[model samples]
Target chain A: MYVDMQTGTVETIMSNSDLPVVLIVEDEPDVAETYKLWLQEEYEVRMAQNGDEGLDLLDEAVDVVLLDRMMPGLSGDEVLERIRERDLGCRVAMVTAVEPDFDILEMGFDAYLSKPIRSEQLHETVDNLLDRSEYDSLLQEYYALVEKQATLEATKSSAELAESDQYDELTERVAEMRDQLSDTLGGIEDDSDFIATLRGLSEDDNN
Target chain B: MYDLTSVLEFDALSQIRPGSSILISGPAMSGKQRLAYDILADGIDGGDGAVVVTTGDGAGDVVEEFRSLVPDMNDAQLGVIDCRGDGGDQAVGNAHVHHVSSPGDLTGIGIGITKALEGLHNAGNERGRLALISLSTMLTYTDKKTVFKFCHVLSSRLDSAGYIGVFTIDSGAHDDQTLQVIKQAFDGMIDVRDAEGGGREARVLGLAGEPTDWQRI
Candidate 1:
């Protein structure tokens, strides 16, 4: 809605500096606009026509990127690789028409959305990405623990798992991680001491 | 939260709690997918997201078939793990559709389902249903042991994540061992087939307090 006709400058209607920025990197103009309309109210929404344009608009201020995988130039895959190489730290959701394959396991994106996304789907993806960005490090550890536990369970019988020392250790670590994650998630709503608490958690993770 | 009372739509299954898995086995083309889709539609109707892992049909076609039963369903309430590959890019308007390399690639399927589950969870849908359509196709591509291991991992994960799971298989295809391996992994089984008097019926097995008698469809 904040499009400057002459300069081709598109911005969210209400430019609230406090709101998180969401960049929509889609090749289809109509799709990009639809996403913009859906997200502009909650985020500082911006649109780029293709991969190159999307990269040009990328910055530290952008908290999330809804990238289309198969764009004309410098495809969304390339854009994602560049973003990771630059260590942008922004959460990238591959919003594309391509059906994901085993190649997706190697992709560096946070989330993937097939094309023709609905309004609520767009909103949910953005919100989820932002929530993840807030607790990035902690979530990684939590997920790792969960995966480890799953791996252990799948490889061992119930009697074997119950008697295994690795399972016991994993269970204890998982319990600790859950408690810490729950406490951290509770503090996310109140940003008063959020950064400080997050920093402390990250430091604890380092140790 | 992922209870079968909403998904199964049967008063008898109201006691089936969250985090339980059900196996729906029948002969080929006996409406196994239809039953699974009905379960999925029930979940969506109850405001829970639905994830469909299809080895048989394309993601779009699966969603289309689902719409035949639930006309007003939206893309926001659905996610698909499409295992069929025609070397063409397939994408639907609003649903989260992840594709695996091939039917034999259980790793690809696992990762795709995990991502879809996370997306639904992040969308604030703590309760959801995940349906793996037609284990027969999976068996065709991979060995029985591989399929069993993959199902074991997936079922265990779904159980712990508190999501209802509906898996379909062709009863006439697999041997007893194959069927038993999968049956041991699930909480219950529903065998669907032709009835004595020109109709289809489902008989629940292994679940407590349910009539062993076949119920008319």
Candidate 2:
């Protein structure tokens, strides 16, 4: 995903394949390290002690964030707001020790867990958030491919209607575009099914 | 007057009262979820309808955890809201399971709880129902003002419906200003922590028409 430096809208581009990354923002060293230990096996984990650091880490390839609610500078909530404002694609889950007040729930976090975090809850939240993010990314790629295919089809139909030498050249270009679109669409479908299978397996394992 | 000690000692958090909001505050890894599960399980075992809304964890994991503890909880009268998916609520056999994608989408949570309670009320059941979970995840994703508003709406709805509401919070997450705003909204507050030994301890910080005590759970 690429962020427009000025508008801050996320522009996602299709890639070959990449490992999901998790950004851990916590001032407490012990806590951050603990999350790293738990998540590193499945994800490429990155650490930041405060929100400012987390923002810097955001320049990297982060798919999800395990943000500590409290920190010395730029608290977790502040960082999250900035991320939303930038339209970052990264999912965030608040890891804190605050009571579950209704006010907190309305703030729009993906998930919340009180601190002294459980290994199970931590892993579950990260896995679910990452899976959701990946699914969303795949869906976007699928739509883009569909749009490209439709555009190519429209160009080809118009070229046929004209039946001129110039139109024939346009038809050749459209065919190439259609092949490319078909390849992209097929790849996305395969990825989507893989993600669905992963989700089903995880659910069954939990059960 | 109504044998307060027995109710406090034997009954789970949800059985304390109808339309009461109970705040279960504690540090992380303090077994808050376990306590919440136990309370819901107790209610289910007693044939009182219950709902568990999980923002961070999957409903299946929670169900599995409960099974690990009680073994017979699969047959219990409990409903779960997964709140992690976009479409359609699924019912596990007779129990209903709802999915929510974000913490901001708590309308689903409120609706699920309301439906459960209405069913119980229609059945002429006055034993009370429970909504157990946390809002910490929601608060972290949004701003303080939005969270405060969400809480106000939820508290008022639960209050009017007379359903038993218990939620956990992490004290270290909020500032004094934000904490005060939340404290004003709750009807009852139980401060839970690890005692000197291995067992848990709880102190009632505030309650409606009841004396406060800094005692153990």
Candidate 3:
């Protein structure tokens, strides 16, 4: 809605606080526009025709990124790689025509929606991603790791998983994440402070 | 002012109470989801707090359909812990909806349920219903014993909070031992199957004064 036709500029839309930002990274103009149209009413929709443009538009403030696979020039996967490298902390979903295989587990995307996705389905995916934003950063990473384990576990046998170094690394990574959570939350650094935190949340459900 | 189970239209379901967890068992496409949703629908319409842990379906669409069932939706309390492993941001239009990446993330799902329950209680709705859309999806990712233990813990959580729990399963999807193991978490079961001639019929199992007749659904 804030699109400037000539300069391709996005003006401040209602001060940006009223709406969560959604960036659509698709090479196809029509597809990009359609997604934008679907989202613009509720979100401050930003569109990128290619991966580089998508990255240029991305910022921590942006809540979700819908990246198109097989985009010419620095593909979606490569863009995803760069995004992870940057540590922007936004949820990325691959909206791709490519068939999802075990290779997808290697890519660091929050969700996968194969093309020919319905309007409502796209809306649902976006909404769910935002809900994910409420979780602490560690949990976000933890669940992504879990998703990969399940994805690979489904397509491969136990012997195959035992043999694959990638699977081993994934398992190690998941274990490390769990250790981090326990390390951060497990022990009482100060008993009084821990008790105070618990008191804030305590409800006597004994009834 | 209604008792937890008295809101349900079905007489057998109406006999259920607070702190009860019941499983709906049937083959694939046998209308088990409908029966469970109906029970939940009635509970929400009667002003109960509701939570749904979904694996395959999007929480937004599920909430959308659920709100439709309750004419007083604006006043209803609902929360969704979506475990379909997909993520993004849209205001599921209403209610507290949290996401976990996959069924494999049981810890995340557990935390989500706790947060949702807090939200509901904060909103002042006391009695409630919690539904796990299907356990079969979780069964695919975890072992039978793990799922059983998770159900046991979840049922106890609901009991402590004074909420009814309705869960579904594809009876044919898992082995008999697995089915028996998971069923132990619940006080009763709604066994759905094909009627003698046509349509679906269900009977309450494991409850005192059990409904022996297959009530046509």
Ranked by lDDT, the better of candidates 1 and 2 is 1
Q: On a 0 to 1 TM-score scale, where does candidate 1 land against the true structure? A: 0.51
Structural similarity of chain A in candidate 2, as TM-score: 0.59
Q: What's the fnat for candidate 2, on a 0 to 1 scale?
A: 0.00
DockQ of each: 0.02, 0.01, 0.02
In the order shown, the candidates' Cα RMSDs to the true structure are 15.1, 23.7, 18.9
The parts of candidate 1 lying over 4 Å away from their true place are A1-207, B1-12
Query: What is the C-alpha local distance difference test score of each model?
Result: 0.72, 0.59, 0.71
Q: What is the C-alpha lDDT profile of model 2 across A34-149, one tens digit per residue?
A: 98998877777789998998998885377788888988989888998897666565677888886565344345466677877889989877776665555444433433333343
CAPRI band for model 3: incorrect
In terms of lDDT, the poorest run of 10 residues in model 3 chain A is A198-207
Give the winner by DockQ: 1
- For B24-141, candidate 1 gives per-residue lDDT tens digits of 9999877888888888888888787899999878988877776676778777678889988653365576777788778876656766777777677777777788899878898898
